[model samples]
Target: SQQGEEDPQALSIQEGENATMNCSYKTSINNLQWYRQNSGRGLVHLILIRSNEREKHSGRLRVTLDTSKKSSSLLITASRAADTASYFCATYNTDKLIFGTGTRLQVFP
Candidate 1:
């Protein structure tokens, strides 16, 4: 499948801890993007890594992409209860945009 697949569909963590999610895709991609959805809210773009980029960071978020392995990972450090949400990875190949299932993260206070 061209769509990405996320590991450990669910995660529970305490505030100030860290959370990590992995995504693996079938085919080559132009870029990979991570997104977060808070309960019933719309998806918020987290980060994007291009084919030439190996890693990227934004605030408390870190993203890594391995084109050779067709996989990517997202890490959120010093997580908070407000971080409780669902994370998703989307891959862009040429004109197609495919998204993974998602990882549900619950951060408790």
Candidate 2:
């Protein structure tokens, strides 16, 4: 519906498995950020990757961006039940952050 839209509206995975979610945008972006939000809570900043960078990693999270395709993806390795939350990809457009529809991740124990 917007510039940034994520695929697989919902994702269910087993604990210790890796979960991947993708986002596609229509326009250019300065940087992309990944965030996680538990049920009924605020978003938590996970990681950020610049347009010039291909990939970035932090703890169990990995993020990749392809400016040419105007797309990005977020990967969570060794997921846990605690990782069950909503993941959103946000892109910097001018001075605003345009966020994707988000993917609901459920890590089964």
RMSD of 2: 1.0
lDDT of 1: 0.91
Q: Which tens-of-lDDT digit does each residue in 56-93 have in candidate 2?
A: 98998888898998889999999999999998998877
Model 2 worst lDDT run, 10 consecutive residues: 1-10
Question: What are the models' TM-scores?
Answer: 0.94, 0.95
True-vs-predicted CA distance for residue 74, candidate 2, Å:
0.6
User: In model 1, which regions exceed 4 Å deviation?
Assistant: none
The collision pairs in model 2 are: none
Model 1 agreement with the true structure over 1-109: per-residue lDDT tens digits: 4398998799999999999999999887788999899998999888989999999999999999999998999999999999999999998767777789999999999
Query: Model 2 Cα displacement at 19 (Å)?
Result: 0.2
